[model samples]
Target: MPHPPKELYTIADASERWGVTTDIIEDYLRSGKLQASVHLPRKMMHKYTRQPTECSFSDEVDVFDVDSCDPYSYMPQQGVFNLCYEDVNWDEAGKATLEKGGLYLSRPDDEEKCYYGFDEDFVLSRDKVYVSISELTRFEGEYGTTPRTEQQDCPEKVVKVSQDANPELHPKEKESLLKIVIAIAIGFYEFDPAKKKSPIANKITNLVYDLGLSIDVDTVRKWLKEAAEIVPRKKHKITPELLSDFGIPPHAKDD
Candidate 1:
């Protein structure tokens, strides 16, 4: 049997279509470079019956049948639900949806076999998420590149820094600041020719603000692009594990 054309793609589907890892798609979503929507099947959205808190009759006349009151009569058609492990059985629903070639969200950090570690950061609700297939296709056309994991090591390029760019700072101070900025760009944003520099610039600007520094974003962006030109493309492959070797401690924060 043939299935209908898909109008939306799940994170997993987009990962497969783009030849990238799911982490990459998630990063794009987290960075606000992509959009998605939460969806639940109409069948699953049906309101569940609930217990009554009190009898409808007066306290002195509480001899009427409790079954007379409709459980959902006073309840809103839509409301919140507890999808926690102890409250709901999500594995059965997730499995059923997948078996039918349908996409469904799995429990986050579930101790059971269905755990996929999906979290509230991705979607507030336990419902599955979907991205417009056309929008994702357009994104891929603009930003798709060779997966970082499969990229071969390349020689570093050398770019001369303009000494007069920031004459107010000493050469030594500039060098030190550039090193810190480059380290953050490489370690956190995987700065490289294939990646966009705007997000990296914005992140560095925020960090500088947190540190009470006054550098403007345009300057930070200029410095990053210039410094990134000389960084070895291979260095973009550095993983979080290797960051410790560079003296970046685990879970280190400004506060």
Candidate 2:
């Protein structure tokens, strides 16, 4: 006879069954993606014992009962995986409503306030939400890329120098530079240009090449420097991996 499936699966079992890594399973449990019920023991006193000098005493206390409690019951219902808005305006409204300490309602303009309540069977759908064009434009203006109106005019002198500078340099270097120039014109220099000449640069250049663009190191560097000047600096401190890509040794001290 075939063996029956077990009632409870451990963390490893869940990971294998879901085709996800063990770390992912742990993350799901932590984020409450998967529901789990835990059985705790409830203590009970069996009987009473009597001693001549001490009078009555407790006898047996080994009895226990299974207490079922859902560990993920306390997870927030408004998490990213649980809730979604139809459009940017609705999303903004939802956020505003949440901030104002009100229940989320699908109809924002209805005369009769209708609210959607959370339930045990509630699950978030992965569909993309629709938003107003004006709201989308506003969102893009605030958080997305602005229109690139500036045209990159590579100086004839610089182009000539790049062409004549070094024949021995890798062909990938040239392609990398061109991409840097384009990125500079559009303003995207969050990384050091020298680092782009390294393996990481090679990878990015390859991606750009696949998109049908040629690149090189010098070209990439120039544009990267320009972009860096135009873009705001990030608040996070740079890591050693980032520094090392720019031909700088891992242990090198920063000036």
Name the best candidate (by TM-score): 1
What's every prediction's RMSD, in angstroms?
24.1, 26.9
Lowest lDDT block of 10, candidate 2: 43-52
Error of 2 at 184 (Å): 60
lDDT of each: 0.50, 0.38
- Runs off by more than 4 Å, candidate 1: 1-173, 188-193, 210-213, 240-245, 249-255
lDDT of 1 by residue, 1-255 (tens): 998658767778777766778777767765656655444332222122223346665454422121325463222222111122222223434521222211223322335322111211222332344566655766756776543333332222111133344347777787777667667666666555447745777777888899988789999888987666555666555655545644565444222
Model 2 Cα RMSD, 1 decimal: 26.9
| Per-residue alpha-carbon lDDT of candidate 2 for residues 121-225, written as tens digits (9 for 90 to 100) | 222221222222333234346644332221123366577688788456475775565444434323222344333343434455676789998888555445555
Each prediction's number of clashing residue pairs: 0, 13
